[model samples]
Target: MEPILALLTAKDTKEALAAFKELEANCLAEPIYADTLESFLPALTAENSCGRGRAFKFFAINARWDSQAVIEKHLTDILGILDDSKAPTLRQCIPYLTYLAEAKPELIPIICEKLDSLALDQYKESMQSLIRRDIEKVLSEFNC
Candidate 1:
């Protein structure tokens, strides 16, 4: 678990996600346990966003925990900037959403507005379907 944290802190989402898979395989992953998840999450759920390399991973990792309270207690939030006017922020949201949709399917609904924002535009339907398919595949893999 510490190694996973180290990987995440190092901004190695790929490695961190790989570690998560291994932990899930063992049924030994821990849900976030910081008592301050609520306190900390607000700062991140911003309409404002960060630079290119420091991409945010929207939802808390949905790990298998010995304590269900840890999962319930955190109350993870997933939000995105759907305004094309905020192109950079919105674009940043795409990858963030991509990662979350796979890693935490519960956040799929959060992308709905963003999906619809592309509506009446070319490839909009395809965009919605693609992300839906991505989350579906992830859920199917986990048998959720």
Candidate 2:
């Protein structure tokens, strides 16, 4: 495994976060990191919340660099994270929709449909507003 990708599975939280930041920088600076997308996909469903969040960020950053349309091929699995039981994961996934939208504008309606289907009341009162805000921000971006 690549050093940065290897760090993503580190036992230490800080180490994983550092690896994510480094990966994010690389993805943002060039399309070279797109080859590693498959490796990060499993992290999306990792038991750890931070792991899931980092995976979301990974996909979001690589959306533009996804020359093979790999992200689009896995679009259903990506959007399904909106139904994740954890509020924090939902919060993390929602904002990344904007990046996905920029990469595939045609998916906006489908994305908005998924966002509208979320059960905000199922989350804690404090989190409900934040999650709603995240969804609204994305929806408003495309005026959906």
Candidate 3:
């Protein structure tokens, strides 16, 4: 876990990606490590995009592994990520939102609302399209 944390906290993108891959491999090998991975949650807001993205992905994986406790603890932070200025970071947050939608059905409307607001923002066309797709995907989950 320390090594994973070190790589994730590294200033370089390559190192952060390495951490992402390492966490992925570990999760695949021992799914229970997802719980332990929760310790990296605070890093999601790292100043570096690479660190934030990797941390978000790691959190998403753990959320998928077991959403109940993770969601209860990090739902607000996860929602807060949608407000990120970085499009890619916001995009990275979608799967976690999707997982939350599945595990906590009541949040679907709020999530969709947030996505709608995000889509209406002045992001590039390509990014807007991606946000639209995410909104569609989340709405589809609830047959909306």
Candidate 4:
């Protein structure tokens, strides 16, 4: 595994979380990490929700550098997290859609369509509103 991938999948260690905080800037400055996008996909579904959140952000970071279509190819798997049962996970994942929209405008329609179909009622009453806001905020970014 690559050192960066190791850091990202490292069980949400302090170092991992710190790296995740700077991931977008780091990836923008040194795009080599973006080349490893495919390797990070599995982490999106890792048992640890933190890892999943990191992977989602990783995808958002790489959306700008995905010349190889890795993100587009695996988009279904990435978006599948919307259906994740845990509200916290969905909360973590939703905002990244704006990054995807900004970086890959062509995908905005597909992303917006899927988000429109979300079943917010499935979540707890308190969380449903928050998640709806999250989704709405992202949708608003694209004027969807």
lDDT of each: 0.40, 0.76, 0.66, 0.80
Overall local distance difference test of candidate 2: 0.76
List model 2 lDDT by residue over 1-144, tens digit each: 456545554444776767667777887788876776776667667676666666676788789888777788887777767877889878877877888888878888988898888888889999999998898888899889
Cα deviation in Å at residue 60, candidate 3? 1.6
> Model 3, range 50-70, lDDT digits (tens) per residue?
666666656655555664477
Tens-place lDDT digits, model 4, residues 100-129: 887899999999999999888888899988
TM-score of every candidate: 0.37, 0.85, 0.70, 0.88
lDDT of 1 at 125: 58
- After superposition of all CA atoms, the RMSD between model 3 and the true structure is 3.2
Q: Model 1 off-target regions past 4 Å? A: 1-35, 45-48, 51-77, 118-144
Q: After superposition, how far is residue 2 of candidate 1 from its true place, in Å?
A: 20
What local lDDT does model 2 show for residue 14?
71
Worst 10 residues of 4 by lDDT: 1-10
Q: What is candidate 1's lDDT per residue for 70-128, written digit by digit as tens? A: 32344333343333333434444445445445554564554544454443233355565
Best by TM-score: 4
lDDT of 4 at 129: 89
- What is the descending lDDT order? 4, 2, 3, 1
Q: Which is superior by lDDT, 1 or 4?
A: 4
Candidate 3 similarity to native, TM-score: 0.70
